[model samples]
Target: MYATLPSPLGTLYIAASDDAILEVDFRDEAMPPCPPASPLLQAACDQLDAYFHGERQRFDLPLAPRGTPFQQEVWQALQSIPCGEHRSYRDIAALIGNPKAMRAVGMANGRNPVAIIIPCHRVIGAGGKLVGYAGGLERKVWLLQHEAGMADH
Candidate 1:
């Protein structure tokens, strides 16, 4: 099941299974056909709204993103990055116990299905430079800035 929510960045398409969230995407194209509303999806959207409003820092929704083991490890590490803070691909690689997998970590970050909730935007390139984001670099910048602003409060 799935639902769409308007966000500061853009339209957010949230998908979920019966029990856990599967994906949250920012697509400019037409939204795919959606099934009936799922409570899980609605909750995910609600959490995202709180996040964009800076009222929420940590996401408490259940997520079931599908990916390889390495990707799973990378995504889990991403969630550990505190809000308003950032990490590099290299840092994520090391967190996952594979310091040599920086490039692979980047690839996995790009493939992250559950965008904001997974906190993929918190990952950056080396030297604190912004890098690849499936949701566009501009949105990535906005998310980071939004988090920083929230942290100041």
Candidate 2:
């Protein structure tokens, strides 16, 4: 099931199965028609709303992002990052016990199906440069700033 909602970045198309969230896409252009939302999708939307409003810092939704094992490891590592903190691609590789796989980690980070919920925006370049967000760099910057503001509370 899926539903779309307006957000700070743009329209968010949230998809889910009966049990877990599948994806959260940033749709600025035309969007395909979405079906009626399932209960899980509604809950995901509510949590996302709380997140964007700075009333919530952490997401508690059950996510079922589809990817390979290595990608899965990278996504799991991404979720471990604190809401207001950032990590380098190299740091994620090291955390996953593949210190030399920074490039591969970058690839996985780029392919993350769920955007903000997975927190892929928290991953930056090795030298602390902002880079590689599927939602575009501007939205990434906004998200980082939003989280930083929330963390101050």
Candidate 3:
């Protein structure tokens, strides 16, 4: 149900249900217990590796991130943000048909269980400023720039 793998950003802890991904935590927190390798975990690891290497711009794994309905809505909106593009919390709130829920949207974004696959790093502050990310601001910047193909800049 879980596995850890090295990435350009850092060690990544990947968790999954029997057929869907559940979480992808950075090394900042206590590592989750590792379970025996499963097909889903291996697929996640492969997709993640391709993403970091710039060979993948989208993920195809089944994901079942546990969260409130609102949070799930926010995560779904995040997926709509095309790779290499960024949006503001306000934009996401509006996209989800709740234009007044910018703050709530931010909170939901913060709690995203799946990381890169859900693409929460694509959300930014009001004026395109890098802001809160569970994976850390630096990693956020790296991810955004990586998607933009400007990682060498």
TM-score of each: 0.94, 0.95, 0.92
Q: Indicate which candidate wins on TM-score.
A: 2
Q: Report RMSD for candidate 2.
A: 1.5
Q: What lDDT does each candidate get?
A: 0.89, 0.92, 0.89
- Residue pair clashes in candidate 3: none
lDDT of 1: 0.89
Give the higher-lDDT candidate: 1 or 2.
Answer: 2
Q: Candidate 3 residues 1-153, lDDT tens each?
A: 689978888789998889899999888555655643998999999989888888888899999999999999999999998888999999999999999999999999999999999999999999888899999999998898898893332
User: Which candidate has the highest lDDT of all?
Assistant: 2
Name the regions of candidate 3 deviating beyond 4 angstroms: 29-36, 150-153
Model 3 has a clash total of: 0
Off by over 4 Å in 2: 32-36
Clashes counted in candidate 1 amount to: 0
For candidate 2, list the clashing residue pairs, or say none. Answer: none
- Write candidate 1's Cα lDDT for 18-69 as tens digits: 8999999997876655533977876787788898888999999898999999
